[model samples]
Target: MAGSLLVSLSGITARTLDGCLDLATALDERGVPLSLLVTPNAEEGHRSVSDWVRERVVQGDAVLLHGYDRRVRDEFADLPAHEARLRLIAATAALEDTGLRTNAFAAPGRRVSAGTLKALRLHGFAVYSDGSTVRDLRGDRLLRARLHGFGGRGGAGETARRNAFVLAAARLVRRGELLRIGLRGADLDRPGRWSALLDAVDTALECGVVAATYVGPAPRVTCSPRGSTLTSVPSGARLVNRP
Candidate 1:
C-alpha cells in the first residue's frame, strides 16, 4: 500500500470550532479526510460542541482524546501533583464516554516528558502522537513523523524548505521508510488561500512525501467527517487523528 496523508487540527478554539465544523462539512463534500484534536479546556463550556462532533463522526472521520487540560503549567500549576494526575484521569474518562479510546493521549507541544508518557500508558493509551513519531510502548509500533512547513503568504517558500527537510529526514529514518509529513495552508481562522495550500501539497506529493495537517496537539489516526477524500491529497499521505 502507498503511504497515507493524515490531517490534524489542534487547539480548536470554541469560537472557531463552529467554523471548523463548517469547514469539515465543506471538506467532506470535497472528499478530504481529516482528524480533529480538541483540548480539554476548549471543550469546557462546549460540551455541545463535542456532542456535535461525535454525532458527525463518520467512517472517514476519527476522534482521538487529547490531553487532560491545555497543558498550561501556569493555570494548572496550583493543583497538587496528585490532583493533576486525577485531572488527566478524569479527562480520559470523559473521552472514553464519547467512544474514542484506542489512540488517546497527550500532545504536549512538540515534546512529551517521561512522566507524561508514563501517565498516558497508565491511562490506557495505545498510541501517542508528537513531533517525532508514533510510539507504542508495548508492540512494535514505532513510526516517525515527517513534518512539512506552515502555510501562509510565503507558504510556498516555507513548504519547499520543509520538503527539503523531510527528504533529508527520510533518508536518515531508513531508505523507503514510511514517513508522515505535515502540510498547512492559510490559517483556518483567517481567509484560507486554498490555491497556495494546494500548491504546497502538490509539491510534497511530487517529491514522494506523504503529507499531513494537524489541528490539535495529538495526531489524527483517520480522515475527517468533511469531504477529506475529495481533495487530491495523494494516496500516500496519512491523516493523523487529533481531538
Candidate 2:
C-alpha cells in the first residue's frame, strides 16, 4: 500500500458553527486533520464561528474561503455573482484578520466560471476542490472525483453503492501515482454520517491514497447527535501545509 493521504470538507454554510465544531473536534480526536472552507457571508451571519475556529483550530489546519450564498441558477444572477465574488474577498480578509492565509478555494455546488477562477487567482489561491474534480489552479493537474452518496436526498443502499464505486476508483488511481482523497459531508448531517464517510477514507488509505475531509467555516467544538468525535480520526492520514 502507498502512503496515506488527507481529506477536506468544503462549503460550510453560515450559522452552522455547532456542526463545524462538532465535526472538527471529532475528526481531530480520531487523528484526522480536516480542512475547513468558509464563505464570507457565513462569517457575516455568524462572526463568532470564525473566532471560535481561529482560537480552537490550529493554523494550517483549516482552509477558509467564500461559498455561494444561494444556489447558482441556469440564468446567472448578477447580485449573486457579485455577492459570491465579494464573499471570496471577504473570506480572504477575514483570514488575514486572524493573521492566517489560505491558498485553497472551493466553490459552492462546484459551479465555477472563468470569472470565479480569475477571482481566485487574483486572491492568491492555488488550488480548488469540487464534487466533480480537484483542480490545481496554478498548475495543470486535474483529478476527477466520483461522488459516492448524498445524505440529504438519498437512501442508505444507494449511498453505499456510490461509496463503493468511488472507493474502487480510488484504488485504481492509487496504483498509478500518489493521490489525495477529498471527502465532504456536504449533504450529510451529524457525526455518524461523517464516521461513515471515514470508511471511504480508510478504503482509500488501504489503496495508497492520502485522504482529507473539508470542514468548511463551522466552529470546532459542537457535538453531533451520533456521538461523533473529530479528534478520533487517525493523524497519520492528515496532510498539512501543502501549497
Candidate 3:
C-alpha cells in the first residue's frame, strides 16, 4: 500500500502570508492540500491577513493553531496543565475573533510537555502533531511521525540537512510509512530552501505516496510500537515529560 505524506507550513504571519500563498498554489496544482499553522497573537499583521486565511480555508486547506505567539518559542514546552489550559483558552479565543476556528493544533518548535497533552485533551482538540508523534485525542492513539523535513537555518550544515531530509522522504515512501514535511514562512526568502522542499515532495510522489491533510481523519497506522500506550498518559503528566 502507498504511504501518506502530510505537508504543513508554519511561521505564517503578515509578512510571510504571500510566500505561503504562493507555495500553497503550487501544492494545489499538484492536488496536495496544505495544513496551515496560524498564530493568533503573533503580530499586528494578522488582522490584515484574516481575509486571506479564510480564503485558504474555504479552498479546503486545513487550519491549525500553531501557538499563541510567534515571539514565544516552544510555547507549550514547559507549561503545567492549568497553565496550558489558560493559554489555549486565550489563543483559541483570539483565533475566533479573527474569524478562524480549529481544534487541531501543532505546537511551536514541535515541542510539548505531557501537561500540554492533558490540556489539549480537556479542550477537545481532535489532534496534535509534535516532533516525534501525532496524537489523535479523540481516538486515543499515537502515530509515529517517522520522517520529517524541516527548513534549515543558514550555515555549512544546511546542505547536509536538506540531503538527509530528501533521503528520509524516499525511504519512508518506499517503506510505506508516514512522511511529514514542515516548511516555514521564511523559507521562501532563503535561497534553495523552497526548491529543496519541492524536491522532497516530488521525490515522494515518484515513489507513490499520497498527499494528506492533518485536518482530515487520522491516517491508519500499519504498525505501532508493541506495548506502547497512551491510556495511562493523563495520570502521568509530571512523570512522563516529553521535553
State each model's CA lDDT, in order.
0.48, 0.50, 0.74
Superposition TM-score, candidate 3 onto the true structure: 0.87
Better of 1 and 3 by TM-score: 3
TM-scores vs. true structure, each candidate = 0.60, 0.61, 0.87
Best by lDDT: 3
Please list the residue runs of candidate 1 whose C-alpha ends up more than 4 Å from where it truly belongs after superposition: 42-45, 71-85, 96-102, 149-186, 200-243
Give per-candidate clash totals. Answer: 51, 45, 0
lDDT of 2 at 232: 19
Candidate 2 per-residue C-alpha lDDT over 23-98 given as tens digits, one digit per residue, 9 for 90 to 100: 6766565556666655544345455755654554463365545453544442112334454567677656655554
- Per-residue lDDT tens digits for candidate 3, residues 144-234, read 6643755456788888887887887778778767778888888877757777788888887887777767776544434434322232111
Judged by lDDT against the true structure, how good is candidate 1? 0.48
What stretches of model 2 exceed 4 Å from their correct place?
1-4, 11-16, 42-45, 56-60, 68-87, 94-100, 147-151, 155-192, 206-243
Worst lDDT window (10 residues) for model 3?
A: 232-241
Who is ahead in TM-score, 1 or 2? 2
Q: Model 2 — TM-score against the truth? A: 0.61
Sliding window of 10 residues with minimal summed lDDT for model 1: 229-238
RMSD of 1: 9.4
